[model samples]
Target: MVWLTMFYLSSMIFLAFFSFFCLLSSFFSILFDVSYFIEWDILGINSNFLVMTLILDWMSLMFMSFVSFIASMVLFYSGGYMSGDVNINRFIYLVLAFVLSMIFLIISPNLVSILLGWDGLGLVSYVLVIYYQNEKSANAGMLTALSNRIGDVAILLAISIFGYYGGWNFYFYTDLIEEDSFKILVTLIILAAMTKSAQIPFSAWLPAAMAAPTPVSALVHSSTLVTAGVYLLIRFSAALEGSAAQTTLLLISSLTMFMAGLGANFEYDLKKIIALSTLSQLGVMMSILSLGYPNLAFFHLLSHALFKALLFMCAGAVIHNMKDYQDIRLMGSLVNQMPLTTFCLNLANLALCGMPFLAGFYSKDLILEIALMSSINMIIFFLYFIATGLTVCYTFRLIYYTLTGDYNLHSLSSVTDESYIMTSPMLSLGVGAIFGGALLSWLIFPTPYMICMSLFMKTLALSVSIMGGVLGYLFNFMVVNYSLNSLYFFNYIIYVGSMWFMPFLSTYPTSKSILVMGSMYTKVSDFGWSEFYGGQGIYKVSMSVSNSLQLVQNNSFKVYMLSFIIWVVMIYICI
Candidate 1:
């Protein structure tokens, strides 16, 4: 295990350097307007063939760099986080497998190879989600796997449709694809991306997946698994331009954002609040992408990854020191005990809230501004800003409960930031959280965005954010009797708190119907029809026939002589 830890750390260092080099290369390539495509023929029939294709454009390279960099930090953090686990080696391997799958997904331009990577992410994520091997972990893993499988099936369907284009290389046919055909393809791809990214109907799995270890949660929810869908759409953005798929994504993603924000405000679990925050941010990215700003969405994707990963690591540190206690109600005033960890946590939270100049600010502010400028429905327009306010609202609520409220834990509980391994990765990511957005913003968008909106609309984002902050403080910390669970709105609170009953809607009805049908089928086919027509029926019929035969055999002996004599007399008479 010690050797494995060292090996993983060394790999992280190498990955960091490689990521920097790739980012540099991508930066230069974009500056030079360079694009490269590489392909290798792997398998084929007479007319149909599978070719492994990879694109080395700025998008792929830059995204790959970010993925590698984050995975490296996660692996480093896991060293201290999983120190007590006996299967630490297995954990490391699974994380590596996850990173590799993400890399594959990142580089491929062909749907076929992307499917390979996509399915790999789903499989490896399930393994990681259930790594604890408990009932809770198992159930969470099942949900994660089943939900992602929906996306996998969608991709397969999209691939089948892409076969009409003579090849699965979507990059080549972005402009060549017929509008009608591209419409269907875009919808399939959006469905796939939606599930992977945990949008709307498929959103339950992201927070549920917190049953995994904290490090796994950090990695998966931040950059690898959940972002897979966003990245997929980024790659397919060209085909999706001017399509209805974008409108559909815009509507649902905005709702998802608002829903997750509302859910986070009601959630008490520390990690789950962060998980919901991730879900909300994912909606932001998807909505921006749907609004014809894939580049801006990609920028936010990278920026959000930096801060969100840091947020998770900070939460992991707090949870580790608090004796694995994750409930926010059980925690308070951590600034006195674990100053460094709390500092990182607060920084990440502020960044998540789109604080000015943080990683989230550069991208989030840009997104809101551009969203305001775009001529969208008034409802969606307001939902976008309201979602932004909700982000600040929940984050401030989280901060009040976790970092500023009175100490709520037992006096004996020891909390410290002495773990160098854990803090080192956290501090490293903390730097990224602070600066990664600015750096990536300049690199990704060499040209500044031109914005034109009314003064009131231009200031709406900040106004909402400030109002949310004030309300968050007043409701969460200042007020003593405010509760969403009060009799006034219990039902509404429950419905919103449960993420609009998405988890129940996705699981309960379908599961109940399947179970009922299965029971009926078992009774009718397995027990009733199978037994009667199969073993029992055969035995009964055979037994009856044998009994009659025996009776005949027993009576025939005595009667045979008389019968034979009668038959002979009748024949002679007739003759």
Candidate 2:
């Protein structure tokens, strides 16, 4: 225990120091408008160079700082959360390794080097997701791993394509590639990004991955794993400008945004709701990136990381105190029991809802305004606003269910806000959740984005947010004589509540057919025809021949002479 404490403290301090250093370096890089690319050539084959590359620019530095900072806090928080577990040390190391993978991913522009980090993130995350060693965690881990493998394959294919050129560094070759090759490369990269980011059809893994421990959830969902895709797209955004793939990404991301927000509104699992919210925010970032604003997407990514981490940590605290009960329906009036956690939770939720001046407001609101200004079709436009409203709706619903009602847990429940280790990290991140947005906006953008819209257009977001909040709260409110209205729309509720049956779609249909085919193959090949004609038939023929030869050998010269006389007699008779 003492060693574990020391390890956590030392790791936290180490990461914190580096985070500050990186932040300062990022500021300097931005101030000077400078970027440094360092490359080491490892090998050359047929004029194609295999090199390790590192990029030191404002973007990489800033993202590194945020990742490091959040990781430090999560590690600190885990010391308290996992203190009783025997394998705390293993958890800490895995998390640190996860952070290291993310760092490698942030700095490397070469596809070859990036795969080092990319695959590391996927492999480590699967291990972490299944850390609980349960069937659910195992299943979730498999889903997460398989979903991400698609992206890894895409990256590998991309590297192969880049090999046709002189180098694997996409930075140097993105614009130089011919149109046909560029489209193929861009499509591969988008497929990769989509899988990593958990866009529609690939999104089941994101919520399923919540089976991981909360600290891992806080890290993986917020900074390390999911954001890898968005970061990759941001790096490639220059090449992605004005392409057909970009339009497709816009449609997909918009649908993802809308789907996640709608699903969150109906979710009961507290962590799953938060996970859906993360998906929603990722959709926002991708959609804005698709609109050709990588900086804005990046801005939202950093800001979202802050509050989302806080949100997950707070959720962890609640789950921890509630004795691992994650159903929000069983939690109510938590403010009385754990005011500090409730406060931090509310702050994170409000920031998520894009409450004015909070971390989400600066980036999220700006994205909305800029998107409205862009010349997108009406479907994309409505999806954006409706999704925005859904964000607030689900948030308010979560707030109502978890914080503002009668204490719904048993009377003997021992929930308290006394753990300094846990609360301290929440407090530290609460500051970020509050001020990180304005600070990020000022630092990331030299000049504020110009807004020119009519009064009605300007107020639409605010109006929708207000309406959504009221409806979210009122809809969840209960009275003694109240009937179960949702039951009347049972099928509809189930359809919408279950992420539009996405979990089923992603898992059952494909797996069912594949599993059935495998069973068939096993029956026919292993037990039926192959057993009869392959192993059994070969063994029988070989054994029969061996027995005849053995009989002849046993009979020795007598049997040989008898057989020769029999053959001679048979020949004479034939003649």
Which candidate leads in TM-score? 2
For 284-364, candidate 2 gives per-residue lDDT tens digits of: 999999999999999999999999999999999999999999999899999999999999999999999999999999998
- With a 3 Å backbone cut-off (N, CA, C), the pairs that clash in candidate 1 are none
Candidate 1 lDDT, 375-452, residue by residue in tens: 799999878888888889888888888889879989798888899989998898899999988998888887887888
The number of the candidate with the highest lDDT is 2
Return the TM-score for candidate 1, rounded to 2 decimals: 0.91
Q: Look at candidate 1 and tell me the lDDT of residue 445.
A: 82
- The per-model lDDT (C-alpha) reads 0.89, 0.93
